[model samples]
Target chain A: MISSIFPSKNFFCLNKLSVCSDSFHLNTSLFYNEYSVILTFLFIATILSVIIILFSYILAVQNPETEKLSTYECGFEPYEDARHTFDVKFYLVAILFIVFDIETMFLIPWTNVLGQLDLVGFWSMIDFMFELSIGYVYIYCIGALDIH
Target chain B: MIVLIICIVLKILVVVVPLLISVAYFTIAERKIMGIIQRRKGPNVIGFLGLLQPLADGLKLFVKETIFPSNSNIIIFLIAPMLTFILSLIGWAVLPLSKQIVLSDLNIGVLYLFATSSLSVYGIIMAGWSSNSKYPFLGALRSAAQMISYEVSIGFIIINVCICAGSFNLSFIVLAQNNVWFVVPLLPMFFIFCVSMLAETNRHPFDLPEAEAELVSGYNVEYSAMTFALFFLGEYANMLLMSAFVSILFLGGWLPLVNLFPFNYLPGSLWFSLKLVLGVIFFIVTRATLPRYRYDQLMYIGWKSFLPLSLGYLLLSVGILISFNWLPT
Candidate 1:
């Protein structure tokens, strides 16, 4: 699957070289070739961040007083803890978002096969959308869309 | 294997170094533009016209104390910024700077971008949750809700682009725009997309979660020094990423503005970068000009307005494309 996407001529040489060396090596490079740049990016980012973290550890002054480390709520003293009950409105909104987000995700595959799916594709999406609209209306009617 | 690893590392450096420098300089650009807009000198004391301000700022932050709240979850708190920074950088792997220049060039390039962006929300959430503080927690909740709200609309807009372009590949999306950028025909989408992009990046006007008055700097309020710097770099990098997205998806990635005069002579990356800068400038101008939205107002715009608008436009474009058989192969 990976090879199918990165079918560049360079892959051929990389593949041959890996095959000649070791099977385990070939597997990694095969995955690497398809996404090596992205992986390398992640690696570099992690390294860069680690360096900064270490740099700060060395240079940054640490004066850990009780007041300074305390949770900031204006300049007040002890109150209820920060981890109190969250508003349920956030949960309701998140659920609503997930439903539509999944529906939107469907559009990607649908659009990819659009021409091949043709009229059937079009109507199926319409039906899919119709159902989705019903869900939207249900949420709206329930005032889930309303800011609490 | 060794050579292959070396080559990959070199390529990563090539993309990242310039990106880091730009992220550094963009801080200056934002300050300068905001200064001009506000009739104030932003920061000219650090270097000639404050040319070295980002360096100075970075050094200052590097040397500042990192405050770890005694009550905070130590590991996750530290990891959150790193996650954000990494997620932002990884998106560039699929972006094409020019026809000849790209890092990975995945078949599902746009999807890769979408995935990375969606994942970035986690960083904010982690920062908020792990902080073990109320303000940061509230900020994180708001950010997560906001991102999800806008992402749905953004996904629909992207699907519309895919429907028109007929492929998920970013280069193909750009190539389809060669004759005419998508902004010309799909003007409403461009508007919705740009607005959603603002929300997506938590920029001004839509920066509800980070409203200083209410949230005291949102999810990263507890962060300081290098940890804070990582988050800062991540946000700016995401801004650049969104700018690149706009240029690629709507402005014709590396295409010359016009086929005539000086436009055609400039290199493709230059053209790409110019459009990107224009997008960044638009963000800056909006920041300078508009007041931040109330949290409720931001939600209303994302769901009630942009969501339906983009969804309708997606359906409309699909109907027109199929009827005219204009769907790309």
Candidate 2:
């Protein structure tokens, strides 16, 4: 019955008090020390930044006015919606960037293995680059790369 | 466990206090330097030589009112600055000040740094979008696009360094620079990295996103009081973080100019700080010296020039390393 819920040997049911206790009791000192330092820093940093901001918030004046909160449009009221649809050109460039950025991510691990692959790996990357160049050229020719 | 926790907290306080103090002084330094460049006295009235100006500024900003923009996304409006402030501070955790100093020496320190920098974009975007104002919305959009563009080249440059160092750990990158700094071989990459860093931090001449003449302070236009202060602090902290990155990647981290006699006698952290200060000065100088680029030109440099140059350099470095059999084992 107990085994049905906890299929993996690594997964111990809390109902099995002795088994759970032993596994949980295993040494955590080494891992704990380094992580604790990070945790402490994060905790303190968060607290410090929060305290300063909160202190200011508490001490500062709270005078909300219709004029004060209104969006600044050269002192005239905003004429159009702030969230108007942006240029499609930005999307085009962004998509192109995403493709190349992902390519860089792939290249990182390949660098680590360059010793073993030798000339074969180099040529493979060249092949990859050739394909990338084709897409880049296509983008250039179409003027997708051009910022209007 | 409790005692250990206390010890960790104390260790953190040591790094935090100095960092906070430096962030304050960085603003003062920028003003003073910019003032001198313009041939004027700057901020000298507060405390002997304007030493207390930042504190006074902090006080003034704190006591001022925080105006919640009508019809804005109130929750996100409030969260944006705090997000920026906290994200900027956290990147220092994995940074190696010296062989002995670091908050946590994570194995994937480079990735950690990348993650934090990338996440900082969200804070800016959130600030801009939440303001429900036209100028900030446009500013936010520009910043997002600009950051994403530059990050590509920055990523490649870092990977190039990691390839030479044979580890993702930043300290190892520094150690790799012991014999000859990466800057000497990767001089072009260094310049590209510096320019990209300038854009990444939204400093001039790449500061189109916040072109005050056009955008009226951009994303932080609607922010005020402590909220504004948080954004201000966060931006300066990020500038310092980027300076640290330049130092660590190209200038041999905390190592002395030469590991000989008097130079070697200087503490590694001291050398690290000296290099960082120089980088900060360069950042301030660039701000004073250059005119802001047009928005399109900013994108052109990032995508057309930097992206291709860094990518091509990566390929060339790989080719050379293979031919010379200099690939790190």
User: Which one wins on lDDT?
Assistant: 1
lDDT comparing candidate 1 with the true structure? 0.86
Worst lDDT run of 10 residues, candidate 2 chain B, spans B100-109
Question: Which digits, one per residue and each the tens of the lDDT, describe model 2 over residues B1-329?
Answer: 78877777787778777888999999999999999999999899999999999999988998999888897898999889988988898888889999868877665678778888989999999999999898898898888888888999999998888878777677878888999999998999999999999999999899888998989998999999989998999999999999999999999999999989999998999999999999999999999999889888888898888888898898788778888989885
Error of 1 at B154 (Å): 0.1
Candidate 1: list runs displaced more than 4 Å: A1-32
lDDT digits (tens) for residues B82-161 of candidate 1: 99999998899999999868888676789899999999999999999999889999999988998999999999989998
> RMSD of model 2, in Å?
6.9
Residue B210 of model 1, lDDT score: 90
Residues A71-131 of candidate 1 have per-residue lDDT tens digits of 7777887477788889888887799898899998777777766665546557878888878
Clashing pairs in 2: none
Q: Please list all clashing residue pairs in model 1, or write none if there are none.
A: none
Question: Lowest-lDDT window of 10 residues in candidate 2 chain A?
Answer: A9-18
